[model samples]
Each structure stands twice: as C-alpha cells, then as structure tokens.
Target: MTHRALLAATAIALAGTTAAFADAHTDSPFSITTIEYGERYLASTLIGESVHVADTEIMPGVALAAGTVDEWDDIGEIGDLIVGVDGTLQAVVLDIGGFLGIGERQVAIDWSALRPVYEEDNLEEYFLGLNVTQEQLEAAPELERTDADG
Candidate 1:
C-alpha cells in the first residue's frame, strides 16, 4: 500500500510539471510573432523592378489628367532609395526612359507616392505603382547623384 501511494504521488507530480512547462511556453519571451506573407519585401528584389502607372480613378480631375481611363503604362524602373539623415526612407529615385541607356535619367519621387502591388498567386513577383501620369514622370526634373569616379 505504501509503495502504491508513493507511485501515485509521483505520477501527479509529473503531470503538474508537464502542465507548468506547457504554460511557460505560452508566456515565454520567445513566443511567436507573425509578419504575414506579402507584407515584407527584400530591397534587392525591388531594385530595377518595373514601375507602372494607370488611370484607376474616376474623379473628374484625375480622369482629365490621366488621359486614358483604363490603361496601364510601364513608366520606369526602380533605381535608388533616398534615405533621411535619421535613417528613414524619404524618396525613391527611378530610371525613366531610354533605349539601351541612351536617354535614361534618374528622377526622384516622394516615398509616399509609391504603391507596391503583389500578385496573389505569386508573392515572389510584384511591381511598383506610381499614381501620377506618364507625362508627369517624363517632365520631372532629373535627380543628380555624385559619381564615384568624380
């Protein structure tokens, strides 16, 4: 009888220990945090990514400025990012126009103007969107960066 009682107490202690371990996991500092799929992107993948412009709005001014109401224009490609002194990304520079590097120039647009759209079927594939018109981009002043060789 003494041996049986000792064995039962041991079993109860073991069960309590298992329960405590499980609870600890739920309250641990190493508990899981989630960054949902498609929410984050690699900078390397964004460089040289094609940027597109489209007339997706129906406001009168927008329609007037947009010219076409339902067309997508491939405007430019991502060139570089402008970072603030405090380390925030403030703007994105794009390489607009040129056939084989003949007439291409860098133009900087505000960071807020960029919109990234990821495909539902493939997260690895995505494109950047800028809501402004193609003409506006073409007319933007060229962004000048000092050359390394200079």
Candidate 2:
C-alpha cells in the first residue's frame, strides 16, 4: 500500500478509537465524577474495617467523638476503624470501646462536614472536627432495652 494511504488509514483508526473512548465516558451512569471521602471510604469500605481517630486539640477523647458520630454504634467491630483528627482527615470519628473487641463504638461523618486540614511533611493520617458529644452516645438505645421492655 502507498505511504499516504497507510497514514490515512491509521488516522481513521485513531479517530475511531477516540470516539469509542468518548462513548465509554458517557456510558458510565454510576461514574463518580466528584470525590466524597465519607461515602466512598468510610460509609462503604470502612463498615467492617478498623476506624482510627487520633488524640488532638480538636478531638481530645476519641471514644466520645465516635459514640456521638453515628446512630449504628450499638453493633460491629470499631477498633479496626482508625480516625485521624489533626493530620489530614480531621473531625473523623474513631471509637475505641466495647466488650472483647465486639462492641466498638460507631463514628461517621459526611465528607463535606470535615474541616480541611493542611497536609504537613510530618503528618501521617488525615484528621477532622467531629460533631459529637458524650451525652449523645450514652443516650443511644442499649442492647438490654428491648429485652427488658419485653
């Protein structure tokens, strides 16, 4: 085949490939265009993973914050959840209390609610400010409540 003809064929193939890529991009109806740490990592993947919340000026007691963070704190393994408070992901919840590591507290916050922490050279994990309180956790429905009521 002639060089010009070969080049023309190659250009046509490239155009077709580009169009295919464009089509694929539009086909992704569930594609995540925006980033949401809470929904992407904590809400889905971190359900069974250890959650960590570091001790910092913002979050002095990790347990208090964790208990007050979510409504599902009555069940599950929470020790695996490590929440960094001052490093990067600030205001994140990290519960560290329970029986035989079976009753760890639940801590969760929307990604949009976290305070943006500046990534530092010495920083390790991300931290954020949590909207939690000790009273809220204690007020949670206990496991014995339903049993006792019946």
Candidate 3:
C-alpha cells in the first residue's frame, strides 16, 4: 500500500481505540466509559513515552528504500503536548538529541504524523510510531515556548 493509504488505514484502525490504565480516582478519573472495552488514556502518562519510526517501504521519497517496521527504531520521547482551545491536540513537542540529560531539545511535531500501532480494538500492547526518520528529527527546528505563547 501507498504511504497515504497506510496512514489512512492506521487512522481508521486507531480511531476510538483505547487502553486501560491504573487510575487514581475512585470514580474513574480518566475513563472513556465504553461498555465494550472501557479504555482511557492519561495525559500525564504520555509524557516521556517513546516514539518509533514506522514503516518506510510504503513511504515515497524517503531516503531509506527498505525498513523493518517490527524493529521500531525509536526517534524521540514526548516532552510536552500542545492542545487547542477546542480540546483538540495540536502538536506534540518531542525531546530529541543527546543521551542521559545532555543536549536534548524539544521539537514540536504535528499530531497527524504519529500513528498508533495496536491490534484490532486492543491497545494494551501498542506503541506510538512516527513516519519520520531520526535524521529528519535531528535536523528539525527546536520548539521554544515563551510565557506569552501559552
């Protein structure tokens, strides 16, 4: 399949897919409230989560001709998330570069670039994948947010 087609398929598969996390609230603080699966994602838990490079064979104009999707080469980790006023996810600032607290810089990536990898209706063992490369990520501009920006 083409890259766009694969992204569409991934989106369709990921839509409404949820995961159950140990919540701290007695009244289900982060519950999505579905009778079938009852899954919810905690925003706080998403930080520091790793994002890997997804399938590249399907992608056109990419530097790599072939790639192992199963390998899931980690590109970066989530540092912060930008949310719109309407409660929509705008972008995710990823902490790229450096190792063990050395030279990490936050790069804001578009929310659409992330693809959730999971089984049918099962997000228990899923991970976030990106259709980008580590080199690209390293070369991207850093995202600096000021007090007025918020």
Looking at candidate 2, what is the lDDT of residue 13?
100
Give the distance in Å from residue 14's predicted Cα in candidate 2 to where it truly belongs. 34
Leading candidate by lDDT: 1
The better candidate by lDDT, 2 or 3, is 3
lDDT of 1 by residue, 1-150 (tens): 699999999999999999999987787675447744335555677678888786563221111323231246877788887778897888888888897778989898886677665444444445566788777877899987689513
Q: What is the lDDT of candidate 1?
A: 0.69
- TM-score sort, best first: 1, 3, 2
The residue-by-residue lDDT of candidate 3 on 1-150, one tens digit each, is 999999999887666352222232346556655532223446676688887875452332222213344477777689888999998889988887778858878889887777655544443454667876667776889897899977
Model 2's TM-score against the true structure: 0.30
Q: Between candidates 1 and 3, name the one with more favorable lDDT.
A: 1
The residue-by-residue lDDT of candidate 2 on 57-137, one tens digit each, is: 333222233333333232333223333555354333445467765665544444443332323332333334433344644
Question: After superposition, which runs of candidate 3 have C-alpha atoms over 4 Å from their true positions?
Answer: 1-40, 55-70, 119-123
lDDT of every predicted structure (CA atoms): 0.69, 0.44, 0.67
lDDT, model 3: 0.67
Winner by TM-score: 1
